[model samples]
Target: MKQVQKIKLGISIGDLNGIGSEIVLKTFDDSRMLDFCTPVIFASAKIITFLKKQYKLSLNFQGIDDPSKAIDGKINVMNVWKENVNINFGEEDPEVGKYAFLSLEAATAALKNDDIDVLVTAPINKSSIQSENFNFPGHTDYLARELEGESLMFMITDTLKIGLLTDHVALKDIASVITPELIQKKIDIIHETLKQDFRIQKPKIAVLGINPHSGDNGVIGKEDEEILKPTLHKIREKGKLVYGPYSADSFFGSKNYKNFDAVVASYHDQGLIPFKTLSFGNGVNFTAGLNKVRTSPDHGTAFEIAGTNSANINSFKEAVFKAIEIYKCRKEYRKLTQNALKKQGRKDTNKKLFTKDN
Candidate 1:
């Protein structure tokens, strides 16, 4: 039997005070995961040791100084910093935030340099992880800046996929940001990402309306008719399969989302509220349209449950697996596209040569 290539998964530990280390350690506890991919965590070995002793969870992982030396049989911790930052499990501290940034920065650099095939990020406190160097809203924005591409916040699960037209923005400002141009741009990215990243040949997407009842056909708001409706029409006219300005209220309740490959919400809550309610503990927040692959658990830092050792590792594990799946899908997609292009070039050359001879 031919051996399958194992991908190297780079993990960025979120706020050390939170469940980042716990979830990471739990997800890697099972030795079966190592058969699929090699996990390289960008965190201090001391933190892992402390967490292991605290939780009394028996898991074996090796600490490596370099990512290239990461072995397939063990979860390798690549030290980002040697300092012993204090971990106040439930309290937010500046030092913890500093280490979080350092881990993320190092892991992101490794991803860009192709040292790792994919990145599985633990939850980071948006408020705490702020500093002079990290001033963005969250991971998506920070990664977008580093990777130099438009970021599409895609929430994924086994049953459903949702993409936000506007991510991490104020609800009051949503109306202004939901312009036809922005909708079109996000739809284009979602369409392409679905085809390439998820391996969907012809993806069907549904777009939710900005207002309730889809503006009641312009009774409540005109954004749906004036902006979204026309944009969806334009997108469909371009040979892309996209539909609706559907009412956010009834769309999911009526199970209309089951008919499409993905749903695009006009703002964050419109998409995420229902998403979390449906798959809170298992959904993976994938940052689409970036040159690099990054996936994070849909839930937040869970500060209240930080040191209790009760945090669910399901979401984090799903994030890791999802990243690997997307990575492999993208690789295969690239190969297929490149081969098709080469074959087309050969046909074009033959046509030109035959024309000249005739």
Candidate 2:
């Protein structure tokens, strides 16, 4: 088999009224993006044209319906929306939601069919893109369904990384969702990603407790002791390096996070609060344990700053770069894994031959 020389990225243009277009334009500003990998965008030709004039960012687009046919040195646009898109500038529109879903659909299809290697997405407006827009709660749920894989909402920075057990779900629904099976699944996903996509040989993972003081020996909450202990036991039995159920309040202060590679939170707020506090606009949202590589910026669609040249492109750049990094890691892992399989195969063949001769 021929080794892949170039990484392919499918870009989704999020809500047009927000800063999605601007970030997309800014991320493509470095022509080096082409040198690193191939870029295919899923959006409208008219929308990108309008964005060029609005942001004064000079970028040429090559129209292609499929990601497999994308060409290098130009933005390959998969135009799912043909109508002239009207941008209300900062105003949210239901049309924006419709178009965002269309773009996501196209991007996702490409990912499943092996047409694209990495899916680097821009921000979107969840509210406007709802039933009034698309009826989906968030990208994590939608993509999880489409990919038919359990999903994880993880935020990463140079300093720290957080994986939320539950994301975008209501607080009321969160406790119900925090089951051992799901927690074990999330931890396994994070561990595998760290090894295969992050090149960590033995990843140290820290699991956060659910309640304050980690349920205070069931005084504060029994969920941590009853629910979490068994799960940790199972994970440890698998020969994985992990420790936790520590007090959520004291875990951050102990500076023990540095001892681990990734932190697993019991809920969304439990993990994200400290993660955003530390990383903020600098963090990159990474979906862990998926067969395909997916990444996005930590921040949301900054509609107010759209086209004002005030939106920060740092997070967008981080997403793009992280996607590339993960791609490389996957490639190296495949190579190593293939070599190991071949080596084992050769040994088996030699053993069989020796036995037959004897």
Candidate 3:
């Protein structure tokens, strides 16, 4: 395979007290990661040094003040803030939360200005990260607001991709939000993301029902029949290959998701419960349908084992690679579209010239 240009990945260290800095350092500790992309970590050098000492891991990184000064083949730490905040491992403190926000806010701004090609965020403590400035469920919701796009939380790995129709909502409110319009919109966004981000020409998507047994022909629930079925029908009529209000239990149990390009669930747990159960250590939470590329590890801030050096870096590694691949795919897709349009324009001009002469 030919090599593509390296992407500049802007990483936001999630919660300072957690394993965010740990995974980021571990992932880039291998010099081979730099061969594919340049890494700009939105963190302070002091924080990374503290984590290294706590975890007893020897890692070196270059510190830079701006993304433009990032050096390839070396881990570059963009010092977002100079605060001397304390790291309370295994505890959530407001001061740690404040630093997390500062790092995230800076990284997000760099993303908006195209200073970075992609954004790969570390795990964040949702409760601690919440403040008057950053009051959101998680990175998915925050990115949706910052980047100005209806983002879909897509879990990705080597095989099987899963998306959620409703994310970060209560189970009690799941039924109310499972409307036909919302289902169709989520599926549409998933379809577009599959094509442009994954380079799938004609994507096949599977949608799970809101009820068990897919409502059992209105026995379990009517939403699957009255709302979901019709919506899938309309999507298919428009030349898209979409299937299923498949029962959540049997769908993953029988491994039916193997046959589809991507799967959409009615709510959060309906999708994530299965995806994580199957591919937790290596899965990536990709924010699809966003104008900018953003991805994160499937797991969150593991406060229980924050500085134990037990944090698995596979998911975080996969997140970085996934963001790079998606960025390349989108660029290639745009180039192909532009070339086709130019060809069509030339052909039309020639046809007009020939007709006038004849």
Candidate 4:
């Protein structure tokens, strides 16, 4: 019998002026969480102490200089910075944003170095976090650049999974951005992700139309009928369980999304709006198709409820759980595939030997 190794969960503290710290502390407050994974928070010990006292949380943490020094069965806070900073609950500050980037950068580096098994990022203030160094629209873009593989913003829950074809793009530009190539790429990514990450033997994917009523058969818009339909047809020809060009307006309301394993939305709000609406507190935003596992809460920084001690921690907790689960699933999927390949190789070699004898 062998003992299972616990996952090293790396956490990046988000905007200080928002509810990121509050929800993080509250989620780990339950001591039972420590049994599952070793949590390493990439922020200063001083900041963690400040947040704990500010929120009056009884959560205890071990301060360390590096993620490798993190101890299992204890909350570990790696001191990414040693300076003491100001704490304002609801105000947006550039200074606070700098520390958020620093935390994320360090945590990401640890993830790349294999020091952490997975990463669960807290919400960051997109506007304030903008700098010359960190110029991406959000985490998905940043992670896609930092890590390998084509990234898809896959929002997941117990039953629903939605992937965006064009995230962080202007609504006006979505039409132009969603070409046949982009559509094929996203569908391929989603199809592989469902099989590899979610462990679905054969995946059923539905693609939402670019226009209302899927261009109403070329009445509302031409993109859905001309672009989406044709590309999806090509994919379906490849023996993939891909369906749709379904009208976005009536897709979810008619409960049509339930029939498929995942839905591909044309743009950001098209997917996220409905996902957040139905699975707000439970959904985990997973960066599928990445070499490293990364997930985040479905919701963003609740700036209004910053230090009110009223922020919901369910989404953050789910993010952590999803990250760990996906890591295990990926490892198992790789092992199974490798074994299958080796067995096939042996069979081929035996067949060649028989042919030679004959």
Q: Which candidate has the highest lDDT of all? A: 4
Number of the candidate with higher lDDT, 1 or 3:
1
State TM-scores per candidate: 0.97, 0.93, 0.96, 0.98
Write down the lDDT that model 3 would get. Answer: 0.89
> Between prediction 2 and prediction 4, which has the larger TM-score?
4
RMSD of each: 1.3, 2.4, 2.1, 1.0
Residue 210 error for model 3, in Å?
1.0
lDDT of 3 by residue, 1-358 (tens): 9755468899999997788888988888787888899999998887777776877776688778998778767788899887677887789888788888888999999999998899999988888888999999888888899996788999998798999999999999998988878887788899998988998999999989889988999998788889889989998999999998898998999989999999998889999999999998899999988899999999988899987888899999999999999999999998999999999999999999999999
Q: Give the per-residue lDDT of model 4 (tens digit) for 183-282.
A: 8899889998888888999999999999998898999989988899999999999899888888888889988989999999999999998999889999
| Candidate 3 TM-score over all chains jointly | 0.96
What is the lDDT ranking, best to worst?
4, 1, 3, 2
Clashing pairs in 4: none
Q: TM-score-based ranking, best first? A: 4, 1, 3, 2
- Ranked by TM-score, the better of candidates 2 and 3 is 3
Residue 87 of model 1, lDDT score: 88
Task: State the displacement of the C-alpha of residue 272, model 2, in Å, after optimal TM-score superposition.
Answer: 1.2
Would you give me the overall lDDT of model 1? 0.91
